[model samples]
Target: MNWKKPITSSLKSLSLSIALVCAGTYIAHAETVGEPEKEELKFGFIKLTDMAPIAIAYENGYFEDEGLYVTIEAQANWKVLLNGVIDGTLDGAHMLAGQPIAATMGYGTKAHIITPFSMDLNGNAITVSNDIWKKMKPNIPKMADGRPVHPIKADSLKPVIESLASEGKPFKMGMVFPVSTHNYELRYWLAAGGIHPGYYAPHKGDNSGQIDAQALLSVTPPPQMPSTMEAGTIHGYCVGEPWNQQAVFKGIGVPVVTDYEIWKNNPEKVFGITAAFAEKYPNTTIRLTRALIRAAKWLDDNSNANRPAAVKILSQSNYVGADYDVIANSMTGTFEYEKGDKRAVPDFNVFFRYNATYPYYSDAIWYLTQMRRWGQISDDKSDQWYKDLAAKVYRPDIYAKAAQSLIDDKLIPANEFPDFTKENGFKAPQQHFIDDIVYDGNQPNAYLEKFKLGLKKGDKL
Candidate 1:
């Protein structure tokens, strides 16, 4: 819908004037960075608040600053979005961190997808139907204010699930996709509470992931989650912002816990492109990453003072398309758990701070560990296999090029990014998981051995 022209003309002129003034000092660097081989690009995204980086990049003229014109379209669902990228209908997409890893490993669709940018962290939550919340409230310990305590554990839901099971009713919950962060987080929470969320024994041809499940988990696309639960088809769902807040707004469900509390600052979605796309359009790849990095920085700038305006842009029909208040509830540094029980959660939807945009191989490995734990990987492989696959899918090399170019232009500070020279793609041992298990990405199999539930070493479904 001609999203490019209005901002492009003005921004391009300004950038050109700036380049001319600094020609003597910057000409050599500019000459080394050639024009984007593919300037006009179409990127796809699901309708969620975390898609804001793509929206902000386009709306803020960051794409134009890189001498590129871009079109951002909201796809119907994650699978459709991934298919669009694979089929060349979409140049790239805001994808689940696991999509590329899973695709490359041949879990679902076989494709060589890779991510140079991670979109955001800690934006998803688990919401139970109002009735389930009612059943659960009695079992949960409360505070002096008579409010349920923060970081409510799924253990509180165990008794409720037991009651439902005794009645011969299966306790069904929904996640957005098999390899989605929502799915893994939901499984982690359920398993920590001693409720088996089930497994996917693909080697045995049972991809339903319902094997030995106490809580039957199925896939419901993000946008349809609230309605799907409201219709009594599902009791709860795990999804990104706006939808979780949508249930809270509609009086249909209560968001029990956010993914932040499940695993602090966990990586969520990523900016993914075909391996061929990155190889063929190296300059374009780096330019797009540069634009996204700038957009992410802008989103998190000034203590998120820009969030309200960003929320307005996301509320428009073409982007997230949710009510401003619903998106703002989470996007603007607070989350509503029960109706009117809003609390400050500054890292609720991280875009740039904590290196949120950097594509870490450790992040990719965490998803793989979850896949293996849940039997999505089916059998044990050497730890090197996990590391090698993560290296193949998460391309920090491209991200580094983009970030370095921005730093060289004095657009961002070097201190804002990892020390690329000394940096290895692994994060330090992470310990904020709901179960309190320590995860050192360098030792994926060791981390897998720590989990009490799901497949471990020498275990197969």
Candidate 2:
């Protein structure tokens, strides 16, 4: 896929604009670093709407403007995609934020993975089979118009699980990857509802995450979520956009709630590469970040003026491959819980707003705490340990370098980013979980103790 050839002409104009702003600084920097080390690059993504940034970057000449050529490929699953980056088959990938964190911590595939950019925020939802939704709807409060009140918490599903348990049937659910944000977010929502979603307990040789769980969660590829739910293999699922909408389109299930309602402005996907790759291709890393940053800015500029066109590109067969309407259900600033129940959800899929591009240490630590709570961390650790691990994996230092270059080139304003001078990469205390439990990122251990269902301090696998 010659991503550059189609956009070369537009890139020329972008290059002219960029050159005019920082020609002198660019010349000096060029003398020191030369051109980008790697120009022709292959990137991998899963067929989910959050992968839109990569497709938009390729389609909008963002990569070409950075003096690079990019090929974006959709992988079969997250494991294959991550392995491609680790083995040098893919230059980088749109990964679950937890992928880089878990891999670096040796939870599953030990690799020195790092993410300089977060792709988007709040692009996931929890969907239930039609039968399950019907069973749960009776417990839900309805509006005066009789439309079910939204932001439906998992408490509604408790009776369904209890009935299944009395019948000796296992209530099953699906998530994309073991270390995926989908898994942790689903677990977080379930636990908040007083339903134990279980733990990994890898030290005990049980990585299934069904230890003391009410609803058993397992891995299912993103594309297969709808069909698997329809076939009765799973009763419910939590996944990124398009797939959940696919269920509504197919009439097999209904999305009960979105992750936005689970945790506001939560980090979703990330651009991941090996630490060795970062060190070996420092210029290549920054250039790639620059391209992606531009793509992100364009995705959110002018109050999302470019989203309709991005929705078109993402609907193409080689990209997300879902029907345009299904992709647009959540992509174009609206989300549909049931057919004909569409409502405005402006932030349903945010790419650049609210400093979405900046990879915060707080975001990384949140995922790590979830990992520890769910037993993926396998043992207890101090708060400083969590912070140190996040610093090692989520490289805000490299992100600053990329953003500074863009700022120096006048591509983005300084106010749009964190105040780099006083920034410590940690966000202030967030109080937006579905359970309303305050999350202070600096005090991860204390936050973990507040959870009623998950592993607590000094608890072993």
TM-score on alpha carbons, each prediction = 0.95, 0.94
Candidate 1: where is the Cα deviation over 4 Å? Answer: 6-32
Can you write out model 1's per-residue Cα lDDT over 81-174, one digit (the tens) per residue? 9999999999999999899999999998899999999999899999999999999999788999999987889899999999999999999999
lDDT of 2 by residue, 129-168 (tens): 9999999999999999999997898899998999999999
Query: Judged by TM-score, which candidate is best?
Result: 1
lDDT of each: 0.91, 0.87
Taking all chains together, the TM-score of candidate 1 against the true structure is: 0.95
Model 2 CA lDDT for position 332? 85
Q: What stretches of model 2 exceed 4 Å from their correct place?
A: 5-34
